[model samples]
Target: MTAQIENTGPLTTEAGAPVADNQNSETAGSGGPVLVQDQLLLEKLAHFNRERIPERVVHARGAGAYGTFTVTADVTKYTRAKFLSEIGKETEVFLRFSTVAGNLGAADAVRDPRGFAVKFYTEEGNYDLVGNNTPVFFIKDAIKFPDFIHTQKRDPYTGSQEADNVWDFWSLSPESTHQVTWLFGDRGIPASYRHMDGFGSHTFQWNNEAGEVFWVKYHFKTDQGIKCLTQDEADVLAGKDPDSHQRDLRESIERGDYPSWTVGVQIMPAAEAANYRFNPFDLTKVWPHADYPVIEIGKLELNRNPQNIFAEVEQSIFSPHHFVPGIGPSPDKMLQGRLFAYGDAHRYRVGINADQLPVNRPHATEARSHGRDGFMYDGRHGGAKNYEPNSFGGPNETGRALWQPVPVAGTTGDIPAPSHAEDNDFVQAGNLYRLMTEEEKGRLIDNLAGFIAKVSRDDIVKRAIENFRQADEDYGRRLEAAVKALRG
Candidate 1:
């Protein structure tokens, strides 16, 4: 426990000086302007002015909670991460659920991908599983990420989200087919955060104790089961109760109806990835269950809420690079970009001392670093040696990396990923569409048409339809007919 300072008196200034009166500011005379030397008054005003920070560029609207992850199976054979070493092992966790394309004050029920990021404060360190509710993403390459997000955001000229901007981008980036299909489907708007599934979405790596490696994907099946809101329902709920999802999540935990998920993973041998018919590391696709079934590993449950939302939840940060021994990054382009992008965003958004915060700090172990002060740095290292390989007994590295060396062969150049036989982007999206029921298919077409019909140019609408048609003839035909019906 941290040392607590005993309070013996009443109101005091931030510097611990006793305050004479909080109600009125010091003045030269009655009706005279207040003196500029009132330190308490200055402190209050200064602090109030600095209350807000820059909100996240994406996933701005969010809700989070404290939870426990209990290993229900032995995953040591697959990975050396201590948290998953044995059955019944428990680790503390914090999970943040969010909407992708919205501001901090946006409605919680909007039709957008939900961020399903989790921070596991394990014994080795904090391992963050930063993911989303959907299994696939819009684009495969990080180079297109900013452009893709720009389309989803407000238009530069119109000052509002335009169907023209959105369709123009999606139509040009054919790789977005799979995710667009998933987005405008029946599960587009989740009924509540608890009633949906979560996925790592990107391929990751798992190295066993014997030096054997595997490609891995994660799935968190909600124990609460799948439930969703229709387009009509979401439209009404977004206006009537913008905080509907956040409120439900908070109240559910408070009333003892704690939400939980069954954690699982699909593992593929490293050797198989090269010949897997499709790029397993592609962020816009998925490994079929017929090839690699999901193996149940553990249970994740949220049982506690933060006392201070700003201190704990708002300041909480995550990055895919936060991994323990045996778990490491994959060659997924999006994941590679995220490893750097996430930490940099947090450094600027929170502070260089963001990790020092109680919410983001490792729970089971103290993080020792030779780093010195920056903005609001606590100076925890004291007068210790800053440089490595020093004569002084500084906190030196173990001379071993937490992650294994990744083999590199081909000369790096500006080229697309090495293609596999079934590498076309439309396949998985077509498969997803075919898997839907008749009613679900009708709704999907209607959803697509509703927005597609709003586009001003016929070329943009045709290009968008052509991408879906490449995925499936019937899907494209139905969508085209729906758009015509809506437009005419």
Candidate 2:
């Protein structure tokens, strides 16, 4: 049946009083100066002036959509998360795709890692799978995160990203080799948000109903098939249309060509983590697919574009720490750091009451917390018990709130140490280099040389080459030759 439009009586003010003269302001006489009593004119100007919030420190440029995640395979044996309990169970989701290092106005086609963050508004709670396009990060420790981001951003002196600053940090940090290789490869410049893969880069713990724990990594393989722009195509697009990715996503959804991903997870038995070939919790590394094959779990489809970009996308926040009952954090230092940093950044960027916002609020369940008044709070828990541990019975703690006990053996200290088997930073990087096909290896060499040639410091170039040399002699030689040619 075709639905007819029902007309609302008239436009009204925030107080629900009918606005008689919305177009004109009150005045002492006709054509006279506007009067101070014009509340409509005053309110419009005031609200317009305060409309913008501070742009995100990173992942500032993004596009978002409303979607549904349906479980295709039962994952209850691995995770007790209610959303994954039964096949065909659907959970509402919001996904925001972004370019990591870019500002709000930066081009979408730049050679950079993309942010792939998803919020699952489940019956239990909001579960945020905050991740990136790549499976590994540039650093394993959260302590280096700020420094690494600084290198990716503008140089303090020039107000522009400097090649020297970027390579200097990466060269000194051998652990960055794996991610650097990925960043300079074909996948770095994704053709659009629809075609690239998404990953929960950090290994996460999934507790089953049986009280057993398994480590898992999430992978969202794009059903559109992997597509990327070469350096030339990306350069041209950057100049032609900076908002290409955003427009592509919006228009595709509007035309009913919805994009989807096949959700899969690589699960490792908790006991095997101790004896794994590489540190299972290392953020800079990946658990080889051969060792732990990804089990198909679900499908995520984006069918609706957001109505308000600022309210739904810009204000949306995702934190790795926001986990439900079955999901928990691993010992990855980067993930641990993010558990605090992401939430703190959101509080500063979007205000403390961000969760109460419509875009962030859980749809299937009402949030019950003793969190009282804060800026922009919706006052949902009015006149309720403000403090916990009270006899008044506010929100009681659940038995599931307790995290599964993880064995701890390392001494608490700030010293930099490699504590796991095959933890040497260069081994995995070398293995990745060897895994690339001949054509890919050639492109990787050219990409590294192209950027390294712009770095003015010879010592930094030499140091970077040394790291590559340790990875593979042929890889180092080809890069060195290419850099020398470009330099000459």
Candidate 3:
């Protein structure tokens, strides 16, 4: 038999030339200062200085894995996306799970919403489904995003998170009522990344080959079941092992205990949006199952752990703008803003050629565009025409017709306004409150009161109580009582 080949190679500089010595810098004379002409030392130090990219403003702490998504049902009548067109079709995917408001070293078990973003490598292109653990978000409009995130972060003066800061913003923004209730509930602190559910959170549009359009919402229910930590349990985990979630995910995968989720979608006919009880595009609400039942589509299973955290996880970028054919955006204000924000943030943090990074690169199809010449450009388009409408046989557009646009009859301006007549903010929140069990409602009240009681400002506390009152009388009364008792 032929000798087994070993691919061991010598170390070299980034320029690919073999290095003579890596352990020492060039010196002027024996025991003298290092020489400035040492190109290897200069190059090594320069690269080390820039080895780290800017961390994400949010979702900074994350863990990722490689997986496969297999379609179990056919929904071709609603969408023409090739990846979901046939049962048994499989798409390779990279999924990143993160804590939304945490830093790179923050405790994973802290009470916070988790990010569940997936990059699907399909024949059409890469489709990124960037979502969160919670089905509803804190605010509906993108204008409130920065301010809202600020509240979730540290106080400028104190350099630490203050209850006053968080409560003041939430109380002032009544749209936050629905999500606040969810946040303080048991689901706020997931037991592990494998045990929580994931949602698209925003309504999306799906178009069939016949040109029929339908509104859609995605839900990934964890096969491991919904498990959450009590405040006491989470606090203990935070102190004992801040990286508990990351360790659990990595160890489980290594032990061959892969986690999985059932993929389902709630689809609404395009024309019915006009007459729907609530705005279909509202990120703060969910489509009631009575009206639109979930249709089972596929399953997502994470079977492999990433070999390199920075290369496969940190450099991977997911954006709402990344979509395959027949799958498009909706009028959700938050989603609309994210289509631009996510990509822009990636470019700024990871470099203009972020898409060329191995983890973020498209595996199924080559990306074609007129864009060229940026930092770390990778020089892939050798001798290819860089512009459209050229005599040279460059890549041409598909010439496909655009999706049908919904009619718009409102005055357009920079100011944000309600999208529908029934856009009352408190109704769905009240409905959600009433849907919970007695024990859960009690826990929610206790959680909210405990957090709000820490706010020094009475006015903020009262304003927050009023918003809760609008959601449900019992909810507000219990919270008010709980806060008073805590103060006593």
Candidate 4:
């Protein structure tokens, strides 16, 4: 019987048993119904039914590529992260570009902030720098985040994105004015993912070997240069080629036209954060170049196209709190809130063992965790102690913290942030408006008016214009007139 064993060829069941036929299901009789005893058929059907996982809440639509980040300048004075410790050191990176407010099936050319998330596989561990294309956000605090996303998402009753909901929310939240102005400008609808810049929008803390802390912001200036599509051009493209951005990124990489970004950082001394004219940690604001100039640090190049989109891109996860030895979170309220929220979302959406997935697992080092037995948990570390502090040589903490301690004081209640001089939301937005060329300003006003005019209520439109009016007299006046003309 052993010598005459069958089912040893290329075509076999999942259990390595040979399959005589994969063309059709087994039947009780020659022409009778299919049998439940056909385990192969059952397995195939069951696996196909459960092939998909839950989509992300916010950045649902995205494209991703694998790449390399090579340090060009020594930043050891500012940080001790191993990947950036020495010049010419190269780190494997995975970058995912996404649309902010769209579902998995939504058009890619819509006017939305692109999610630029990078996962660095460093020797210490996996470090995730999750950010957006824009340097500023709509709200400074994370408590208001859900409400802001609700306005952008589909309305419950109407089942569509209502202009009334959008205008109403913006009118009430004055903090949204800066990001709103950015969203309506020419750069909002990028021509392709490769053309626009990426930013670590929130301030972060970088501690050097001597434990000197520096607050920092990150930038990725595309070597391809900035290119954007006008509203009319975007409208046609969104309708005609919904996957244009995704297709462009994949095709560019495949054709050997790799995309690259010149990485830079704006470093501010930790002590100077408090006395700055405006709140430095505010998520809705930015430090002017005149205050802290950007220092070029590295080069990021995306060269490889993902072979399996679902495995490499869709299953990948990132969180802002995934820092290395030198980098840590800042006092930005939004950043603090995200430290919990992003990890929680991934734990629920992906399994707790999502880290074990190939795309998310650390490359150079093993992820030693006591956590065991969750959905999809690969039975690694067999027979090893599940708990730390075992006498049998289990992995233990290194006694050093991954990041330096930040000092804190005062009451811990819901007290608002400390008020700073010139901290109002309108100043930077107004400055941005004034900096635009005459033609660019006209396009921005037109874009704002085109959307605002769709509001059902006159009061909503009036309130919307009032926010921009506070930013700049000319901006508000021009936008109000443009909205009026569009409505008529």
Q: Top lDDT: which candidate number?
A: 4
lDDT of 3 by residue, 123-213 (tens): 8889999999999999999988999999988889999999999999999999899998889998989999999999999999899999899
Cα lDDT for residue 93, model 2?
Answer: 98
Total backbone clashes of candidate 1, pairs 3 or more residues apart or in separate chains: 0
- List model 1 lDDT by residue over 1-488, tens digit each: 13357987988898888899999998889989999998899999999999989999999899999999999988888888888999999999999999999999999988899999999999989999999999999988888888988999998888889999999999998999999999999989999999999999999899888878888999999999999999999999999999999899989988899999999999998889889988998999999999899999999999998777788878999988899988999989999999999999999999999998999999988897777789988878888888887899877788756666778797878778767889997999999999999999999999999999999999999999999999999999999999999999
Error of 1 at 356 (Å): 0.8
lDDT of 2 by residue, 331-421 (tens): 8889999999999999999999998899998889989988878799877887888887778867787756524678988688895635577
lDDT of 4 at 441: 95
If scored against the real structure, what TM-score would every candidate get?
0.97, 0.94, 0.95, 0.96
Ten-residue segment with the worst summed lDDT in candidate 4? 1-10
Q: For candidate 2, list the clashing residue pairs, or say none.
A: none
- Give the clash count for each candidate: 0, 0, 0, 1
Task: Mark the regions of model 3 whose C-alpha exceeds 4 Å error after superposition.
Answer: 1-7, 28-30, 414-422
lDDT of 4 by residue, 450-487 (tens): 99999999999999999999999999999999998988
Q: Find the 10 residues in a row with the least total lDDT in model 1.
A: 1-10
What's the lDDT for candidate 1?
0.92
Clash pairs, candidate 3, are none
Which has the better lDDT: candidate 3, or candidate 4?
Answer: 4
- Sort order, TM-score high to low: 1, 4, 3, 2
